[model samples]
Target chain A: MHILLVEDDLQLGSAIQRALERLAYTVTWLRDGQSAIAGLADGSADLVLLDLGLPRRDGLEVLREARRQKVATPVIVMTARDSVEARVSGLDAGADDYLVKPFHLDELAARIRSVTRRHHGVAANRLEVGTISMDLATAEVSYRGERLELTRREFALLQALMERAGHIVRREALENSIYGLDTVVGRGALEVLMHSLRRKLGADAVQTVRGFGYMMPREPA
Target chain B: MHILLVEDDLQLGSAIQRALERLAYTVTWLRDGQSAIAGLADGSADLVLLDLGLPRRDGLEVLREARRQKVATPVIVMTARDSVEARVSGLDAGADDYLVKPFHLDELAARIRSVTRRHHGVAANRLEVGTISMDLATAEVSYRGERLELTRREFALLQALMERAGHIVRREALENSIYGLDTVVGRGALEVLMHSLRRKLGADAVQTVRGFGYMMPREPA
Candidate 1:
C-alpha cells in the first residue's frame, strides 16, 4: 500500500522507510508537517504515518486540518510523546492508531496491518479477488489455493494491483506506490517487472492498457 | 450521474443536453472527437454519449484509443452509421451500447440507464444506502421507508451525494456533476441547497467537512 510517512528524524525515518519497503510498501517520506498536510489532501496515499512533533507546523494541527478538510485517509501517529494525555489527544485529533516512539518495528508493522484490516472491514490481512488470494501480513500469494512464488519487486507490484483489483491503476500511480519517492527508476523497469509477474501468475493475469496503465480483472482470465 | 456528450451538431447536441438535464443528470457537452478523447482519459464523467462521425478525429478512433488507454468509462454510441459493418466495427472499437441516429430521447435515456446498471452490476435503477433509498428513474427519495418531498435542485444535489454515500465528495466534484457545464452558480448556492436537504432528512443526514464538501454516512447516522 502507498504510505505517506511524515517524520522529521532522518535516522528514524530512514529505518522506517527501509522496514516498510521490506514489507512491500512504497514510501513517500516527508520531514515536515506543512508538507504532510498538503500530501494528505492530495488523497492519493492509502495511509499516513504522522509524527506528532513536526517542523513548520505542529502535527496535531496538521491532523485537525486534514480531518476538517474531509481527508479520510487512515493515520497512525508515531511520536515520542508516550504520556496518556498525549495518546488521548492524538486519538481525539483523528488518529487511527498511536505508536509511542522507540518502539519495535514489528509492533509498527502489526499496527499497520490492523489499521488496514479495519479500513477494508475484513477480519484479517487478506485480499481475495476472484481466484487470487493474498495474505498481506505474511506476503503470501495463492492462485486457486495453490502457493505461488514471486520476487520481492513482483510481490510489491502485485500487491499494488491487487488493492485496486478490478480498476485501472494509472502507470504513474503504480510507480509512486511501488518505489520510494527518491528512487530513480529506468523507463522499462515497470514493464520488465510486469513481464516477470505475468509469467509466474499467467499471461492474462495483468492486462496492459497500452498508454494508460494496467488492470487486474474482477475474475481471473 | 455525469455524462460527457460528444456531438458536433448544434441542434442535436443542445437537444440531448436539455433532455439529460431535465432528467437531473449533469451534462458536459463537447463538439468534437479530439476533446472527447481527452474527456474520457480524465475519467471524471461516469458515462459518455459519443458520435461516430467527427472532425479532427473519427469517433471510432477516439473509442479505440481510449480503450487502449484503459479508459473503462461506459460509452453509448449515438450515430447515423447503422450498417452491419459499422455496427460490428463500433462494438469492436469498445462501444458498450449503440443507437441509430434520429432515435427518440426516451430511448437514449433508457440506453444510458441500462449502461449504468450494467457498469454497477445492479438489477434496477435504485440506490439504497442505510435507511435512505433513491429511484433514479422516478427521482424518488425516501428515508426510513417514508417518501421525502424535495425540490428539483435538492433532488439533484442529493443524487450526487447519494451516489458516493460513504465517501467525501469534494465540493468541486459535486458542483461539476450536478450543474451543466455553462452554469453560473453563486457561492452559497450549494450550501443553501444542502441546508434544505439536511432539514428534511434530519440534522445529521449530511456531514459538512468545514472547508471540504460533504459526506453521507454508509449507514444511518
Candidate 2:
C-alpha cells in the first residue's frame, strides 16, 4: 500500500515514516498542506493521513479542495485537535476516519484497514477463487485444503490475480503491485515471476491475455 | 504499502505499528517466527521488518527459510543484538539492512526507503512523458510548464499511463491502479476520472483502445 502522510511535526513525521515502512508500506511524506493538496491532485497515494494544522494551507482546506475537485481517495484525519466538533467537521469535510494524537498504532492500522476495505467493497479480509483460498489478514493461501508454499513476490502476484479472478489483469498493473511503482522493472522480470507461479500452481492457473496481461480463470482450465 | 513486521516484543511491536500507520503503511504485524514464515510464504508483504530474538522460530531462521523457499522480498533486520558478528551473520543470512533496537526512527525510514528503492531499480524520483512531467519524490505534475492539479486517483492513473506512454494500458490495470485490486468500482467510475483528466489535460492527452483499454500516444495524438 502507498500512503501520503501530511504532517508538520518533524519528530512525529519521521517516527511515523519509520513505523509505516517497518510495516511494509511505501510512504510519501509531505510537511505542508500545499504540497499535500498537490500530492492528492496527482493520485500517487492509496490513502492520505492528513493533519489539520499545517503551514501554507490548512489541512481542512486541503481536504475541502480535494473534495471540491472530486479526488475520491480515502482520507483519515490524524491530529492533536481532538474534539467531537472537530471530528464531526473532519468527517463532514470528507475524511473517511479520524484519529487523535497519542493514539495506539494498532487502532490506526485497524481504521486504515477498515476504510480501505470499505473503499474496495471487501466485506472481509478473506478472498477465495476456485479451490484457492487466501486470508488477507493472516496472509495465508491454501489450495484444495493443502497450503501452497510461495515466495513473497509469488504470493503477492497470486493475490493480485486471484482477487480479480475471471477478469484479465494488465501486466503493467501486476508489475506495479509486485514491485514498487517507481522501480524500473526489466522486461522479463514479470515473465519470470509468472513462469515460477505457473510451475508451482500448474500451467492452467493463470491465463495470458496475449498482448495485454494475465487472468485467473473463474474455472481453472 | 504492505509490510510484514516480525517482532516478538509486544510494546515495541505496538509502537512500531502505530508509527508506520501514521506514515500510511498497511502493516501485518506478526509476533512469532512461524507466523512470519507463513506470512512470507503467501507473498502478501512488499518487505519484511524482522527481529532476530523472536519467540517460537528465531528471526534468523525465518530469514533463512524465506531465502530457501525463494521468497525474495527484501528483509530488514531490526534487533537489539548489536554486534559486528551478529550484523554480519544477519547480512549473510539474507538481510538487506540491519538496525539496532535503540536506533533512530529517521535512520530506519531512510534505510527502508533506500533498500526498497534499490530493489525496485529506481535510480531517480522523476518521471516524464511529452509535456507532462512528474516528480515522484514530491508527487508533483506539470504540463507544458503549467502546474496541473490532479486528484490522488488521477495522478496515480496518469502516472501509470505516462510510465507506459505509447502502450495500451489495460482497463483492468488502470482501474486497479486508480482504486485498488479488490475495489469493485462502478463501471463508469474510471470513465468519469478519465473524462475529468481529459478535460484538464486536453482530449488528446489520453486515447481509448476500444475494447482493450487506454493509451497515451508516444507522439501525443
TM-score, per-candidate, Cα-based: 0.50, 0.46
TM-score of chain A of each: 0.90, 0.79
TM-score of chain B of 1: 0.57
Best by TM-score: 1
Across residues A1-221, which tens digit of lDDT does each residue of candidate 2 receive? 56788999999998887776555455667788756765665444678999899987799998997776567899999878879998999999999999999878777777877887898897646778888887755567788888878777787788778767876676766765565433556879999999998888888889776655787988857
Please give the distance, in angstroms, between residue A154's alpha carbon in candidate 2 and its true position after superposition.
Answer: 3.6
DockQ of 1: 0.02
* DockQ for each model: 0.02, 0.02
Worst 10 residues of 2 chain A by lDDT: A176-185
The numbered model that scores best in DockQ is 1
Question: Per-residue lDDT tens digits of candidate 1, residues B89-193?
Answer: 675566777788867554576578776765665556688888888876445578888877666677767777786788887786566555544465987888888
Per-residue lDDT tens digits for candidate 1, residues A87-118, read 99999999999999889989999999999889
- Local error of candidate 2 at residue B169 (angstroms): 22
